[model samples]
Target: MKKIIRGWVLVFIFYMSMGTVYGTNTEALMTEKAFINELLKVSKTGAVLLTGSDEILTREKAATLIVNYLGYEAIAKKQNNLFKDVTSSQGEISLVSQLGLMNGLGSGLFQPNGKVTVSQGSLIINRIKNKLETPITWKHAFYAIQSSSQKEWIKGYDAISFGWSQLERDANNNFIISTSNTENDFKVPVGFEGPIDLAKANGVETYLMVYFENKGMLAKSFLEDELQRASVINQLVSLSQGMTKDGVTRAFDGVTIDFEQFLSSDLKELYNIFIKELKSALQKEGKKLNVAVQPTLYFKGYDYKGIGEAADHIILMAHDYGAITLTEVERQAGITTTPLTPIKEVYDALYEAGLSISDKSKIALQFSFASLQWQSQNNQVINSRAYTPSYDKIEARLSLSGSMKHFDHYLQSTYATYEENGIQNIIWYEDINSIHSKIDLAKLMGITSVSYWRLGIIPEAFNPLR
Candidate 1:
């Protein structure tokens, strides 16, 4: 049975190769424990179990095996304690409870003696590909596995083998894998290459030291970089969260407070402090300090007016016309009304606050590539539920026949609506269709510059920022 299964797998690979599906090189060496650890890191739910094998190798067992083999006995014990803490706190079982790669199997019960099936192996690899925060690189390659005659004749065996064989390729494509395997090995590989050469090649042994700076898991370095600027903005707003926009704007204008006191009462004070330190550090690194302030309409009637005096440019958040509440006309038109009023309001408030925001060229109007769904029953606000309109929901609502056609129409219609509504400044969320529409719209609107809500959320396709 096993021989027959292996034969079928071989045939499938042959067919795949002929079909030009087998392309990536799979010969990169990675340790089993590292591979498993990565898999757990990338799993969507933080839990991945070994499947495809006849024997059940739970996540717990896999983790235990990794800890024991890696000689992390003390760390393993700590992991067990962490697991207990997480389980007790969450009142649910989560893969994060276990510190090791295979979940929380513990020190003594990893069950390395059990056989792994093809399905189980695929699940593990897939989890790794999905969960790792770092990038991976994938190279296509043909894979073949030999099965013994005594093994069960399972169709899934070929599927599983093919699946595991693709892990290296997937990781490589994402720029995560330092190596891959073209041939089979019972052991795992280690030390895969990363996209960021400084960190990947710097011999930085610990993720904690390189990124978190000893704060450990309590601080998320990746998120910090991505959100630091936004955090500063949020902090500024939060400092006067309870005050009316007009009052806050006024306060910002005349308040004789230092930068520290400026951010003292905000929920995001730490972020503001971090930004100050970051600016100093960047200056030392020979980077210029360019700060841009984008004011929202919520500050129209607030205290601080001359807020843009300290920065390079003042961006006006010109969208969100339909944010607080939408009118019946907006609902029928399938778009927000003119955002000009709010934009002008914010501009006026900035001027009133005494910011030296010069000509219009220094101010850019921000637009939205996304839309909101107003949940209304019979045209009257039904419970005032609003949702971000997604492609799938828009298609379903329009009863479009196919995803491609629906997406095409949706993109065209959305862009037209924005243009027709006379929205000049725009910033798009990180989405392919939205980005494409913004490009086309920019050409139509004759706008020269655009910005993104974030750099991280932007897809790899737009990484070059053409």
Candidate 2:
């Protein structure tokens, strides 16, 4: 009996040092030994064994987890320029940088102590998952990328998004050329910002969504006559043809219809025909077709089944819930602040659209990085037009230093409020933590893929996991 007890004690020590013990019967023993072990303990899932008081993850902690927990010692062995003020997390930060999973904030500063946001955290985890290259064997991955406003980026409303906008500034800080959202006809200028990069799309299939800026007028013209609709279809075919210009090809594997205009059921049929025709056209050229759909609750008149059958990938754009408070109709409903995209509501709507879990393998949950801003007086919000700043620009302008950051447990969003004058300002937007929460919800719903609405708003490293 004495010899057996001594052997168990030795096993506990080995387990503490090993950190990750996946052997049979050992898991139960590890749990019992955890009560005695003080240096380190194993995770309930047996996926990780973290040190005491290191429950919170940092860059260094992440590195250790990757090495010890995930057995990524080869990546963990590599190191970059270590900071003078940093005594820990160097290996993790270096491993992250070496794999292109994370980048420094300029000047070789890793800021290891800084907390990682949902976007950054999601990016890292996704990259790790990709690096592992584990076979899903069940769910298929669907990706969605959107081509949105050029002005939002050129005007600096979004810091990161401007990088993807393709609008460059001269040495004097002036736009090399001009772009406008007022054009009725769609045209990509010389080397104009297209959609997100498809080359680094990794393994999962992706769709490049082109924004029909003048969709309202196009819908109006199509409604007037069938010939006009045909003409519109011709123009769309021409836009897809534009992708092959200047001897460059394979920019996008598929073309996504990002029309958000108000379409009647009749127009929806016409649009369906348009999509079918577009899919046929792309098929002729050995390409694919995809689409960005509106949330079922907000946008009516869409034949979800018809569109779903026609498109190779369907992206459910379920953002803008928080915009209700700023809308003309919802302000009358006496609503205040809310999440930009509530989790359960989005999932319920998508699932009810008749797409089963298996069918959703090619379906994406589209997310937005913009925030809703409004002023409040006497605890009542002031009515305003659409006003949202990109996550980066807002972070640069107002930080959590003077403001209070609150997480909505029910909605899974991050909001910040600060006072510039006597008026109170409330802004709710997506962040790293909130993004992870949403992704968690998607994973729980058996979703295989998710998407960002636009490029450059979120870090390029923060690619969604398939």
Candidate 3:
């Protein structure tokens, strides 16, 4: 059964995003004990959250029941009372103490019943991550940054104007990054001219990101062994560092690695090592380094603290707050085609991420303005596609689809239904209102910089001076 905890996630995504841009096949690629620590941390607040499980764990005793699941031999061998106040069952306090993942404050008074502080929580997680097995093989140079067809440029607005209409003239001196291909293997194809032309024509920078996926994976295998992994990343960095020399790229300009939703927890150490090493190499060449990662997963013990500290800028891919369903199972479970980037969803996800990630100055929340098109039969969706309708296209569709203009105040996005020959078509899209939500979200989060997926989707009128 799908864990359809609909409406549980309010800060943005952290909502159940169950499908693709219309269930397009995409392969990809996270740890365990640290999760218990998170639950323990959350339990301290006494905030009872109801998921599917009926037990609301606000008490430490209930939280300690998970320690027996660790299956440690030392747990059974315990014959001594380590603390006077410890009351957890299954020898959890003993095992945690033996593992050196936790400690007492003073005089052998183990605060098993006490609330976990940030420092204590960090120590526990770091200890667990440090012991994770690592014997990974370096992936061979099997992938290349191959370009695909250029995005259809809308006339009159130009590429830059399509990004955000409120964008000042000075902001156009920066790069506008977007992905290409079938959403599986995001690579830099041959002669796809968006960032390059902008870089050459306006002296803006171009950051060509390259990645591959087998349904979210690191080259179809877990990439471990930091030394060998560094070699592979070094090659990619080596190519990227000198990749855009012909475009007259300026300082604080280089490749932005958009490899989010692909890395597993066991591979995070290697991933961090790769970024740290890559940043070092890029810095030596006076090139800037930026990495794109999801804020929700960053808290799952994936080592954002290391990556954020290493990269020049961290592009928080904060969009995709909700999801569009594709499969029969998802649709059957009350999955609706909703906003691509709901403002409240973003705020909630970011709020959770902000608990772990420091230094908001380095973050540039990547705002999205896209929607999904679904065609349903007998109240069930049969097929769907990611539809990014331009202003004129939206107008034509509205006239063709219907004029009700239904709005989801929670999502802060609009959707409409129309009957084309008695077939129901649902079009959920972004308008100027979506952009306003994004601008408000950025300010609320105390973030400064913002990046658009492509320079031509929305328009320049919405982008404010910054």
Query: Candidate 3 residues 84-146, lDDT tens each?
Result: 776544365654554445565678777554433334444564554443321111100011222
Best by TM-score: 2
lDDT values of the candidates? 0.30, 0.51, 0.48
Q: Pick the candidate with the highest lDDT.
A: 2
Q: Where is model 3 more than 4 Å wrong at Cα?
A: 1-203, 214-222, 244-252, 297-301, 326-337, 377-392, 399-401, 456-466
- Model 2 — which ten-residue stretch has the worst lDDT? 157-166
What ordering of candidates by TM-score runs from best to worst? 2, 3, 1
Candidate 1 lDDT over 31-113, as tens digits, reads 34444554444423112242232234444444444333222232223222334323231211222233113343565333333
Better candidate by TM-score, 1 or 2: 2
RMSD of each: 29.1, 16.2, 19.7
- What's the TM for model 2? 0.55
TM-score per model over all chains: 0.28, 0.55, 0.53
Candidate 2 stretches greater than 4 Å from native:
1-186, 192-210, 213-235, 238-252, 324-335, 354-358, 397-400, 459-466
